[model samples]
Target: MAKTIFITGASKGFGRIWAEAFLKRGDRVVATARNTETLKDLVKQYGSTVLALALDVNDRAQCFAAIKKAKEHFGTIDVVINNAGYGLFGSIEETSEKEARDQIETNVFGLLWVTQAALPVMRAQGHGHIVQISSVLGMVTLPVLGLYNASKWAVEGLSETLAAEVKDFGIKVSLVEPNGFSTDWAGPSSLHTQPLDAYNKVKSDFQAGLTDDIFGIPEATTDAILKLVDSANPPLRLFLGKMALPWVTQVYSDRLATWGEWKEVAEKAHGK
Candidate 1:
């Protein structure tokens, strides 16, 4: 059965590749971006199968409108991929209040708004999938990428709870945690070096190391996404890339170690 997929941030990066991958597999894709004009070529190539919508995920109204439009055009969305997000790199102390709020608004709250709007439609249809394009940062925190990590962690928590809440309704939520992929996600659009004297000693080298331009191709992530979409029973979390596996394993091990070391203190502090 050919399913209809609604993907945000479809103008570029993993979102764009995922859109193409679904289209290639004969699935209808309702691709959205802040600037729909950028998807002109895809729209032309896929014709009616690719319904391109102009959507700013940060805007609640836009998120609602996009969902309604997608439902109208595609009849019912079998999958909703919330892939619209950007990275914010800086020490939490160095990041401005406004910048922090903006990061949460786009990367965290925007995803919430989209999911809120899509859930009703999916529930009505009886079965659907929600795929969150997260990152390995969601599992582990690094030095300068605190803001980005926080956003992804927020998504991870939200998606985990959402999965349980909607499973009875036949809605499946999956988090796609890709390692660094070669995309504009690490380019100029990526927030970096907020210029704090406190961070000067650590900022330059950290920023250089954090650049994701040299990572695996976007196609690899897309392939993982497709497999997840087609699986008989998909996992709640799909960690993509060989490089990502080690980091994820380390994160789990580190967390367990920390918990074990602090177990006595934690129990006492909690009055247990």
Candidate 2:
């Protein structure tokens, strides 16, 4: 069935690609960005199938209004892709309070606001999909993307709780954790602080994807998004890239090791 899909951050990157793909398949897409003007070309190309709207995810009220507008236009939103977030590149110590707050606003609170606004409609409709555009960084931390990691980790936690809470209502939540993609997410779409020299040499080694070299470019992930939303029973967490599982598995393996090492201490917390 053709779906009424609402996508945030539709101006560029994964969001834009997914919007175009959905439109190509004859699905109705409510494409939103801070500047709707960027989508003029998309609307022209897709015709009436695309509804480009101005949306600043940091603004809670604007999120509700956009969802409301989508519901009014398409009757009900069958899918919502919360792809509106940017990376904050800096060490935790070097990151500014304002920068950290801004990251959380868009990556965490912004998603929450959109979900809150859309939940009522889904409950009424009895079925809907909430897709969160998180990152593998959500599961594993890196040197420079501390704030970004924190924001995505929060998304994972809240999204898991949301999935359980809404399952009874027939509403589903999916956390899509794609590794660094070839998207502008690390380029123009991202924000960064003046780097501390202490992090420069080491961070350069880990963040090769930040450069213009061949291995630095991210691969296309639009097909992964298609597969995710098309499934009737999608996973609560879906890793989109080949490297995603390897990276996440390492993190989990270390966690399990630490837990096993402290198993006796952990068991002491349980009632005798």
**TM-scores, one per candidate:** 0.94, 0.94
TM-score for predicted model 2 compared with the true structure: 0.94
Q: Candidate 1: TM-score?
A: 0.94
Worst 10 residues of 1 by lDDT: 205-214
User: What is residue 32's positional error in candidate 2, in angstroms?
Assistant: 0.2
Against the true structure, candidate 1 has what lDDT?
A: 0.88
Q: Can you write out model 2's per-residue Cα lDDT over 1-272, one digit (the tens) per residue? A: 89999999988888888899899998999999999999999989989888998999888899999999999988989999999999988888788889989999989999999999999999999999999989888999877888899999999999999999999999999999887666777778889887788878777887664544322233266677788889999999998767778878988999999999999998998969
Cα-based RMSD of the predictions, in order?
Answer: 1.8, 2.1
Question: What local distance difference test score does each model get?
Answer: 0.88, 0.88
Model 2 misplacement above 4 A: 208-219, 269-271
lDDT of 2: 0.88
Pick by lDDT: which candidate is best?
A: 1
Report how far residue 226 has shifted in candidate 1, in Å. 0.8
